[model samples]
Target: MEFKDYYEVLGVSRTATADEIKKAYRRLAHKYHPDVSKERDAEERFKAVSEAYEVLHDAEKRRAYDQFGHDYRAGDEFRPPPGWQWQPHTGAHARSHRGPNPAEGFSQTDFSEFFSSLFGEGGFAGFGERAQQHARGRHSHARHGEDVTRPLEITLEEAFAGGNRALSVDNGSERRTLNVRIPAGIAPGQKIRLAGQGTPGSNGATAGDLYLEVAYRPHPLYQVDGRDLTLELPLAPWEAALGAKVEVPTLGGRVTLAVPAGAQSGQKLRLRGRGLPGKPAGDQFVRLKIVNPPADTPAARELFQKMADTLPFDPRAGLG
Candidate 1:
């Protein structure tokens, strides 16, 4: 039979601590587990990993293997030492064999011929039961799948009006399309959870959830602050100097706004409950921007000159 380097199979150092050996075994076992792994050689790898762990994880078996296995490399033709014999009922071996019956639910035939020759077919009775229990425990402690969060960008119009949106999500292995509902007034950074849409769970556990964080796409006419909306309203010079009921655009629709007399540039006018819909909904703020008509025509130049002559107010009066 060929010699097996149990430490090399588990990817651990010869002097590795027990805990390190167990950790390496668990990681490889989980990766190559036949039920969960997609690798073509997963079943073969899993069997190899399990076989390596069985001998290394047991103290007496590990000690005997190390004392004799040091001279032989993996795949080398191996033979037991000249006078060695299988002694399962003697001294230290007798004490270690007191646990569960290894043959009750396990078969030594499943292991390699090398392992059978090294430990005798029936000598590993205790460890076989232990390995079976470990497999059962791994399934009993199955973990829930992890939650995944991603950003979802939408137009301001879509945010203002609640509606359904079709979103395509790719999770490495496959692409899926989902219909998501956007709640009216859903603010940036708020999350929408889709149940059982994230990574799949192990051992029949429930799948995790998918979270979509809300974000607004850039809009041409409005700036968003939470649920509030701000728009720069351009006004003629005459409209600012004298009060006027001007047409204003809001998320809901167009509305009339009463500009106070002598309204200055940058002055803000508020329209309650006109920004986004919700409980005590947000307000729309219209910022005044006075636009002066250009004096390009001869008649427009005369009108501007007349206004400059008649209006004696100095804009720089506040300057020291």
Candidate 2:
């Protein structure tokens, strides 16, 4: 195993405040977001950022990392400390002793090898053995299974209205397809719990729940701010100056939006209750983006010359 410096990954000091760490994570996440970023390595970079944040953001994990990582530098060859039962790259040993058991449920595939080494896959060092003991009815304690959490990405449209999805989950032994219902008015970062859908319990105890954390896929035309939606409404310069009603796409359908007279570029107009559906639904803001016509034709050039000769408007006057 190699020591990974999470602080260095986030470009923050070891003594950096929680707020600073959070800001750095958010900025890097946005910069490397796979859907929007043009960078060839955006996806890999984003994953690394996310992994770093996952550890540094947690107080317990951060404390453990700071203590154990004090003597090591990033990328240094690492070995487990005394009494720690971690064997790096020991696949054959892991399979023989800690192999996957159907009742133990599936392993969390989202985390990296570094994270798994630190956290020990799930809650215990040898979960498969414990599960096997429980199956044989030899285990004394009856403990509930550990809860599972997975990321779920949904489109803005799908988020607006409740929908159903078929998902394939690896339940240790096999891949099981399950139908999931997405509740109406679901928000990002919120979890949808599925009862008894996690690891099977030990000694016939009740199973834990599965939580699906909601995330939004990037949209080309709109941006989500909590419940509110923002969209850039492109308009001709003349249309912006002289108010006009234009058709705009919404989650519900296309609707006519009235632009006020003398609307400037970046001016925002609100549509009440037109955003994601909920009680006291969110509003949609349409921001005007005035697009000037190209002076390619003789008639267009003549109009531009006429405006330049007649109008006394100086757009750069504010710069003074």
Candidate 3:
């Protein structure tokens, strides 16, 4: 997967502060929302803008992204389908769609969920509150409870096919385990919400949501890029030059990687649909990192001498 420049997505610069980015996201998304707009590609554009906002609005996600570039989402990539689902009752979306100030620190997805909660899918919940308020404005009790965050580490295999994750958290010094169904193709720093799992509520309402921030323990030899998995495959000089079928590890399992004869070091090979799975699975990138064996033995020395005498290739011929 290619690097998604969220700053570019929201039409802002890297130097733009959180507030500026938020404003841009709202302006662009509101213009493109399908409900009010008749423009072509409005829905697609709206999803893009919302996706961008989901990253830029959060301080931690933004910082990780700025430091690592594409590597920010190395463990996961948070791409929701055109119609996204969220568990708002979990207080995971605390800052979105509350009072007048709900706009202060919300990703568009959070805001959209708030609307979705009040008005069900296809507007089934509808917009009765807004219409009824015209005759008699009621006090807005839809206060956003505090957002709860917890860190979780998953294996490379689990990261690939996301699903319901059973987890526990300490709230008021008490731990409670809950099951959270993670979406497939989730990337690191992307939050998973468990609705109605947050702080104690007033008005005898149910508890709020618990937000689980996804991360991972580094897997040996495997590095993630968006939904794609990358591996720096070490090969012997002979295998790289003479072509071989070498077994390599993928998140799914092991598969034989084809090495073309005379393939250069740092050559990249793509394994189609072998990465993180979703509606459309991502590809795996195998970068060939050639390793020359040490000439510790006479046999190794003789092999090197023979190769040096026969091979006519100049490895660094490009540098003048």
Candidate 4:
């Protein structure tokens, strides 16, 4: 298999500090996240960057890779050093091919054969702080896998009413599709945790968790403010002056809204408890906008003149 130079992959110098490596990884991860990026090779690039960070972010893993990997370059044919032998991080490696609990280990899918050969499957099992213990050859109790978090974008309707989502995520080495449940009334920036779905632990340690942060897509007609929903309510001149019941849209369904007499543009009407779901559900605010008929025809012009004459009101009094 071809060797992978993780530091080069992250665009960092081999001598870069851990903090620098972390900054580089975060910058690349944000730029290449498949869901948000429009770049042609976003998925592939994202996977490579994630794999690089997985190895380099850990002190022990970085040490081992750097110490043993210096002689190689990216894409160079790689073979283990002479006298090298696979040492089991967990006794389970002796029991069977199962080696270690799959959930506790880092994902090896989509990894270069080079990485797989070096770390093997159990390499990332003790990925958390306990991984440092493994480097010292100390026998530690069960360790939890490191948690993973990613952004998830949803529509307004989906945010209003929780729904089952089918999503694909980078499960360490490869992209894996999953059926995720979105909680109702979920707001942007709120995270949903999927237990035991992250990096696996060594030996019999518990697997880490995965977190999905909620983000809402831009809607054509509505803007969200926390749990509250805001929309422009267009009204005819007569409806604003004489009052009328008009149908407005909500996630649940259409609601008939009563337009009070003398309603004006920019006036806000509140529909209580009609927004996103929560302990005390949010309200929906409708800003009224009165639209006048265009005087394109003779009759329309005549009617407008008649109204101008009949209801004499100075709109610019305040401005004056």
The 10 consecutive residues of candidate 1 with the worst lDDT sum are: 96-105
Top-down lDDT ranking: 1, 4, 2, 3
Whole-model Cα lDDT per candidate? Answer: 0.74, 0.72, 0.63, 0.74
Q: Write the per-residue lDDT of candidate 2 for residues 87-137, one digit (tens) a residue.
A: 222333223121111113223455567767875643222234443553466
Q: Pairs clashing in candidate 4?
A: 103-200, 104-200, 104-201, 105-200, 109-173, 125-202
lDDT of 2 at 71: 48
**TM-score computed on alpha carbons, candidate 2:** 0.55
Position 196, candidate 4: lDDT: 58
Q: What's the TM-score of every candidate structure? A: 0.55, 0.55, 0.54, 0.55
Query: Which window of ten consecutive residues has the lowest lDDT sum in model 3?
Result: 118-127
C-alpha RMSD in Å of predicted model 4 compared with the true structure: 18.0
Residue-level lDDT tens digits of model 1 in 163-254: 88898988769799977767667778877666557787676554566788888899999988877899999999899998899999887889
In the range 186-261, model 4's lDDT, one tens digit per residue, is 7788776565567876765555767788899999988889889899999999999999999999888999999999
Give per-candidate clash totals: 0, 0, 13, 6
Ranked by lDDT, the better of candidates 2 and 4 is 4
* lDDT score for residue 48 of model 4: 81
Candidate maximizing lDDT: 1
**Candidate 3 lDDT over residue span 249-315, tens digit each:** 8878899989999887789999999988755788999999999899999998999999889989787
